[model samples]
Target: MTDRELFDTYRRDVYYLCHYMLHNAADAEDICQEVFLKAFQTDRQGVERIKPWLLRIAVNMCKSHLDRRKRGVLKELKHFLLERRRDTEAADEALERKENELETERWLRALPVKNRTVMTLRYIHELSLQEIAETLDIPPGTVKSRLNRGLRQMRRDLGKSNPNLKGAECLE
Candidate 1:
């Protein structure tokens, strides 16, 4: 497939992955653009795959964006204390879902960046361990370890106040 065609097919998925990682739609769009731009610049010769390549680019862009964002936030005490509020209203079911999602986000925020990336790729993107390893350029064993550790941390976080939280899948 041509670069444009290949990237077009995966754009939404890539954007979702970026959005999940950055937690900001604007940053995710920027990262997605960077991913596609990098793909356009690279030599595609001897390349037997496209999705993994695009994902690798996307993941690197996400990490870089996160790093820069971290440094920027560190420089401002007032900005560091500010929180981004969710804008959506809550229905009964929506409220429950949002609560669970917020808790998951809290858990995710507590883990190391690498482990959080693994968990997002594994659970949100629904990528296989092998696919994740290839995309992240890590060994499969390392992905497994990060995933396990992230899950354990999430479970501990969820179980802190409510034992019933353990009965539901953390992602739910």
Candidate 2:
């Protein structure tokens, strides 16, 4: 495919992936541009699946950007503080929050980055396990393991507190 055609076809997908990973629209746009630029410059005649290839670039770039920000060290503390703050909300606000959220979206945000990426690619983007493995450049086995572990972690962490959070039945 021509560069413009490829870009037009997958731009939203690439942008959504970067947005999902970085949680920042500007940064996601920047990374999405870089992904397309890099893909355009590379010789892709041998690539069997262009979308997965593009996604692999996006995943790597997002991970690199996250590493540069050095927020991994603060992730645990931030998660803890956010949880504490949310727990102090009044019942009315919490009820509003629940009403505003989709059950899966709520649980997906509660997961770690690795598990979140795997789950997002698998569920939200509707990629097959092998496609996800290619997109993330991991073994299919690793993808399965993350999905499994993510399910358990999501349950153990959020299930007891919010017994009504019930959208995780398909992550297996």
Most lDDT-accurate candidate: 2
Query: Candidate 2: lDDT of 154?
Result: 66
How do the residues 33-99 of candidate 2 rate in per-residue lDDT, one tens digit apiece?
Answer: 9999999999999999898889999988988998999755212110111244577899898766665
Per-residue lDDT tens digits of candidate 1, residues 1-172?
A: 7876877798977887777667777888989998888888888886666777778889778778878877322110011101234345446755666666666667777888778778777776678898899999999999999999998887777677566665565435
Please, what is the whole-model Cα lDDT of each candidate in the order they appear? Answer: 0.73, 0.78
Q: Judge candidate 1 at residue 104 and give its lDDT.
A: 65
Candidate 2 structure, TM-score to reference: 0.74
Q: Provide TM-scores for the models.
A: 0.73, 0.74
How far out, in Å, is residue 156 in model 2?
5.0
